[model samples]
Target chain A: MSQPTTYSLSARIMHWGMAFLLFSMLFAGLAMVQSLQPWHLTLLGLHKSFGVIALIAVIVRLVIRLRTTTPALPDSIPALQKRIAHASHWLLYAAMFAMPLSGYFMQNAAGRPVAVFDLFTLPAIMPVSLPLYGFFREVHALVAWALIALVLVHIAAALHHGLVKRDGVLQSMTGRKK
Target chain B: MSKKTPSALPLRYAIIIGAVGGLGALVFAVAGGLGQSSVTAQDFVNLQEGGNPHLGFRRAHAKGFCVAGEFVSNGSLQPYSIAPQFTATSTPFVGRISIAGGNPTAPDLNAPVRSLALSFGEGSSRWLTAMNTPPVMAVGTPEAFYQQIQALSPDPETGERNPERISAFFAAHPETQTFRNWQAGYTPSSSFASEIYHSINAFYLINENGDRQAVRWAAMPTVSNGETLDAANANALQDEFFARVEAQPVAFDLTFTFANDSDDETNPTVLWPSTRRNMIAGQIVVHQAMPESEGNCNEINFDPLVLPKGMAATADPILRARSAAYAESYRRRAREHFLNSSLQPSPQKESENNQ
Candidate 1:
């Protein structure tokens, strides 16, 4: 049994598309809560819309991962490092699901309905509860920081595989494109 | 998959690329939080009265309370502007009255400048304003203001401002003279209810006839307390304000003093002759004021550029600079207060707090 050379085209597109959306959503969430700028209101709208989009995109991404083949690590990498990589990938998937759900719960707890780009509003699943809102707000913020930290580590690993080790671990995603 | 690939880069290029990428990320991170390398808004905030880093209060006018009110138009402004507030219909507004200073605990009597900032309506229809006790603006331009503040900042080691430096700067920027004179005769208002708040920066009012009129506005207290109120209480002004409002609504006559063709609409520090016709725009009645933590105005930015349809910003650089500086100030205060304090001010789009 041989592993594939790179991710499928659909996976690559979803990967980059969701990458931009998630990065922007994080900053928007941070700045909107931290400031009272009206521009932040628009950001709040975009953040909500993009969060929903990312959530849907991640579901598709997970499905794609299950159906299509994925590249395997090189023989040079350690078993422990491989296990860590696999675990971290699962954690990233967990974060993608949690971020938007936590935000939705936070808004609902605060007695505010989550509106997606003003296209339509999501029915509040949780009742208005200040204590619960605080709880979810804290969770949202903590998870965001954790996710960012994880991303930085992931990037560092990719750079190492590509630049230092000169392995195809990164090229599996980049596909040797200029 | 790990396949042995050709060396992606020369060692020198890899090191250079790594160094540049790291530097770029560092710069981006810093810029994202603290703004550009040469930040101006925080600098402006530092020069404000009682300006200092406070845990959960504004960089200026830290001592204040929230207020809810209505702008009841008297129809006098219909000729000057096409704004909805002038059409004789009552409109809701959230406002804040504050003692000018960065220190929230500053004594009320020590406040030479009082401020009133307001936000009428929400979303696209919102009109935000900030006014101060001074009849005219002290600093004409943002450049002059920056230089003046730089001069006013005390020596880091000595902790004493050089009087000669201030004098020289003022001498160089004579446009600040009107405000200087106002400051020399500074007196705390008898009470918040009796204070007059002036919109020093001129704003244009576009009428139905396609006429653009630049005017300054004021919220003149309906009652004159004549400096009879006691100042011994640290929160004397706020105490009296709350007490009076608890009994009956406190009110102000909103008047817009039209600017003459010869007057300098661009310079805020320059005062037009007192003889200019001051037309009553409306009456602002503040029904009540609550502590900032409990008031609706706590989250409001009160950026002056949030004007309604008929009103617009003047070419005055200070007006635009004020909008920018206010945003920076709001960002700092909101971040500090929301993050550091236990109070959860449920984030709302409709809010107001300014100085």
Candidate 2:
């Protein structure tokens, strides 16, 4: 069976860019939390800034998706696999947007300026509240780990389709066999 | 299933974006906006440097502490200590120079860090704490700052700084390179007084007109101006500070140079190029001295949050965080001292042994 034509050039670019961004952000976040030298602050700032960029890109990508249809999965693929793909995609969207927002809220709640690179500042959207701050912090932390787990699962599923299943699902996203 | 795509977002979307952006910018302008809060040297000296209202002196006091003193350096041998009530007045202030640690005779270059404080007065209002480091740190997050401290502490197994671990951590986190440049010739364990510079991480000041500004308190040793530590001149740094205090009690003055928000923001690190543009606003004098025999040094609480009007702390997140952390650390140290009793040896005893 043949694979259908896949994502547009713009969609593919946004997808891959967002992927690289999200993964780099995850590592940078981990490093920032793990290190404390004066420079780690730079890392945290970069992480946050990149996270915001990914989020914006995600929004634009979503808009593009709404304006242009994505290629459908192969009919031969199992229904369960399709459902997993759909759920994972939505989860990535949620994470790409939510993580940056959570961090922004966290800094704002602490009365800190949210600098993307110290280049431009993002305005605070919420007032300071210890309880709400704590809630967002917990969510931010849990979401980070959840995102990590989900990304790992994503990698595994993609590999299963590409290697074990030798299916075109993974290839479609990568634009390798569309 | 493949579905039909929707059309692009309408021009209304761009209008919505512009309106949102415009409204946000306007509100920021009204609220002093982005530029309003960027702390200037004038802000520090003029004492107009307001903090996040939710976490200012009022909130800090609600959480259990208040700004007790604002010691501004008048560029004299004597620095003045302004109480939260004192304003627009300048006088000679007392300054104390010492080595902080378990032992008294240790070399200054042995330590990777040094702290210098100018005690502007004889009582609770006397202290302005500064480190011998430069360029403010980048770790804006409180949690990251704390974790970094633990990582830098003496190794649990070796009872020493684990070089491999420290090196790896430094390599992994390259942001420490600036600090590393400062620490290259210095050791992690030494008498602080012997170092060429003494600093206060976040210090603020007030001017003649009761205006406030944010400042870093630095003491450049006339004798030990270079990075390399001279064992011979070690005593010179301490002796000069004490001799001047002993001669006139009011002889020495502490000076403070203003750090505008722009310069501060650019280099948030301690290395603010002290030699170049930093300005000295006021002076302080030493009236009376506290002997190691007084035994009250342990009870002393040197908090940067204790600013007077005409001298307000900036919204510098690190300053805000450190004020709370320092207070908590001070409290915890006091509690530990009370509980252990023998945890810290007397500096007098150590000094006598060296003699």
Candidate 3:
């Protein structure tokens, strides 16, 4: 097998696309919960629709990540750091899938239909139950905070790799070819 | 893998980085929760609409009719704010006129507080959320307001407010004595058509060249009637307004008043000087009022913080508290509706599965 130095173009595209959508939804959801602006409903609609799109993108991204030849960590990295890096990445994948699914089910438990930009709407699949809705809402909110915290660490690590370590790790998924 | 030299992050510091980030998030969640500790949004929602809220209703202004109208500005506030609502543009809006408290059945003529909540649709400016009160508010902070509500709340056993708590609140805030004097001399308006709605919190209006002017606005009714509404009839107030609107559009001159340099913009308890100049910024002609069943303005939060580009909230703690409390109120009411209208399992689907 050939040892690749960077991620493929398709993986890079998916990474950036999902990153934009994820950040936007997080901030918009925060704003929507805090105020009752006229534009908030529009924000809600976009959040739901983009969440669905993210769900699809994540599935494909996961497949690509698994099938492709991922660049190996540098020999300078310690064994403990490598394990932690691997664990954190898996946690992120789980969170990416969990976020959208919980929100979708929360809406389902509320017995409200999810509309995709007014083009189409999906009907509720679960019976209307307050407990279920509450559970999902809590999960959605908690996961959001966790995801935000994780992203902060992730960004710092990337900066450390690029600037401090002067490693090509940051360029692995940033479209820079070796 | 490449020829370039690589440096590794220390294992000890990597864990610390994530741990610190997690700690930061936890701190934010605790510190930035709603409003002040004593006067949280959760507290307001629980006290007012807690056990069983009226589905699809506001926690405070629970009962109100929706008004559809067009705001016609005279461009008088051009020097203070370039907000579209202050320009000579006619902006369509929907609003509500409500009384104080969570109980929708509260008597209209006997209402201690009359409220006006408006959302300007075409214009980006936030809603003009106000109540019919003196130029200043009764309390300096939202914590005081919440404490006053708590003190006045009827005791479980006695069904009367605790005299000690009431006295303690009054004694602690000597500034509230002015409110008592104002309340003693106040007179109730016979109709919603006559009462003037005052925005208790002050806002800074940003003009061209980034100059800031502190200002307040009120919706002053065009016509006043000495006619007293029927105190016995629960629907009498709404009926009167609806009937009057059918004949002619009830108009209110939307006016903005500039604040003096010495005025205390942060404290709601201190009244602004009467010598401050007033300019008629616009006129709102409410053509018709839709019933609560229509769900027009009934669902709006009227968050005062959702201002246009040119307008900004001052350092008034009450204003910040209002945004948090209002958000909590809207969320609970909307959730109540969502919970009440949950999907039921169909018997037909079960029978079809049996096949």
Which prediction has the highest lDDT against the true structure? Answer: 1
Candidates' TM-scores? Answer: 0.68, 0.43, 0.68
Candidate 3 residues lying further than 4 Å off, grouped into runs, are A1-178, B1-38, B50-52, B122-128, B342-355
Name the weakest run of 10 consecutive residues (lDDT summed) in model 2 chain A: A32-41
Estimate the TM-score for candidate 1: 0.68
Which candidate has the top score in DockQ? 1
Could you give candidate 3's per-residue lDDT for residues B1-355 as a string of tens digits?
A: 3444333346535655666566566546543653224455666677786365654467887766788898998888877777777777898887888887776666666667887778773324444455555656778776677777877777767877698988888898888887778778878777888888888788888887678998888889899874677778776778789888898999999888788889877777777777898889889899888675453564455777656657777877777667667756755655655565532122122234448
Off by over 4 Å in 2: A1-4, B1-63, B67-199, B202-215, B218-355
Candidate 2: tens digits of C-alpha lDDT, residues A18-57: 7778767766654444232335435655776776787788
Interface RMSD for candidates 1 onward, in order: 7.6, 17.7, 8.9
Over the stretch B229-260, how does candidate 2's per-residue lDDT look in tens digits? 34576343344444444554332123355555
Sort the predicted structures by lDDT, highest score first: 1, 3, 2
Give the true-contact fraction for every prediction, in order.
0.01, 0.00, 0.02
Worst 10 residues of 3 chain B by lDDT: B342-351
Residue B278 displacement in candidate 2 (angstroms)? 8.6
Q: For residue A12, what is the lDDT in candidate 3?
A: 86
lDDT of 2: 0.49
Model 2 DockQ vs. reference:
0.02
Please give, for residues A24-114, the per-residue lDDT of candidate 1 as tens digits: 7776665554332224445655787788788889999999989998988988899999999999988988888889888888766544445
State in Å the error of residue A73, model 3. 11
